[model samples]
Target: MNNPVITIKNVSKSFGKNQVLENISLEIHSGEIFGFLGPSGAGKTTLVKELVGLDTPTKGENFVLGGKMPSLGLMERVGYMSQADALYGELSAKENLEFFAALYGLKGPNRKKRMEMVMEMVQLSDDLNKLVSNYSGGMKRRLSLAAALLHEPELLILDEPTVGIDPVLRKSIWDGFYDLKKKGTTIIVTTHVMDEAEKCDRLGMVRNGKLIAVGSPEELKENTNSGTIEDAFLVYGGA
Candidate 1:
């Protein structure tokens, strides 16, 4: 296995009196797709935010690319797609790509090439000139994913990336993810979808701010004596 690209040590987070995460610790290695599987309000997004340096833990620490969390240099090496679409309403799809590409220091021919490449990867090449405001919910999601890939970052962090996408397009997106993984891009995805969870190389199941289980889909099922990832999750959740 490659060296650990992400390390979380006894991480915890709290908002006012509510504790969102409690004593979470995990190591994510390089060049694999790791999934955080859990339902809504399970603190999956909060954990991911910490990984991307968008939020800091109230306790413990997070390290990415061998650097401490919230490092500007390390942020450049990571591509993040948040749950909300962050796009210019009046700008065309191409324009949005151009803006973000520039933020990553992509310029001239390189920027153009990357823009085209990511758009094609997300199957949005034909909609390059469409205004973002006019794009449907699913189209917006795809565009957001394309923008995240524009920089070809070593690590890709996606939070609920496939939500609102149709089954056919969702499969296509997953295929693209596998291609990225093959190229040594470590991916961290948070999803409540069981089928998607099974596609991950390994999974960390979170519930009520705790990591309940950690294993590959097959290993999780076998260990829990269950037939599916969902069943394994249920067993872990004490269902």
Candidate 2:
């Protein structure tokens, strides 16, 4: 916590005339898995997209790894995996890795080593030669995760990473997250799943493009006099 890896200050975003984020402000410390929980259209993805510099805030500032928003220089130190799969269908898994790894300025031995390490972590080492077009939804999700970790980035931003993944595989992926955290990687994940929210070191519950609560899972439930995160969210929603 000595040096926070990510900071958002009064950040807001809009597309055309519709506001997607409203004065969102938060901090993500290094070496932690922080979860953003919300229903669909709750601005979880918008906030994360802003953090990754894919979209700029309309009114405020966002800083990652100490640099201001949308800085090309900071891209190498941050890894991002959006909810949508962004892979080339014609490319083999290994080829896809090669392309993205190169984008992060990786080459030679470092690139190969990282590529192998990420594939192994995602339990897809054997599928390196498979064409992505043949991959199932879960397989593609695993591949996306592998690609995101290929750079060993100091900060990881994952959006609904486990949506289509099976429970066993999902647990393995979360295990990988913890291992990365131990190695000092700051991870930010957006999910609506309550169980996943409970696993985070801290959580931000958002609704209608606004943050309703920020705390550890236990703290949130206790504060709301609820037995679970879902219950707490309901209380916050005045249900």
Provide TM-scores for the models.
0.99, 0.97
What is candidate 2's lDDT per residue for 1-239, written digit by digit as tens?
Answer: 75878889998888889988899888888898999999999999989888888888999999999999889888878899999999999999999999999998899999999999999999999999999999999999999999999989999999999989999999999999999999999999999999989999999999988888899999999999999999999998778
Error of 1 at 239 (Å): 1.8
**Local distance difference test, candidate 2:** 0.92
Candidate 1, 1-239: lDDT as tens digits: 66999999999999999999999999999999999999999999999999898999999999999999998999999999999998998999999999999999999999999999999988999999999999999999999999999999999999999999999999999999999999999999999999999999999999999999999999999999999999999999999
What value does the lDDT take at residue 232 in candidate 2? Answer: 98
Q: Could you tally the backbone clashes for each prediction?
A: 0, 0
Best by TM-score: 1
> Residue 207 of model 1: what lDDT?
98
lDDT of each: 0.96, 0.92
lDDT of 1 at 67: 95
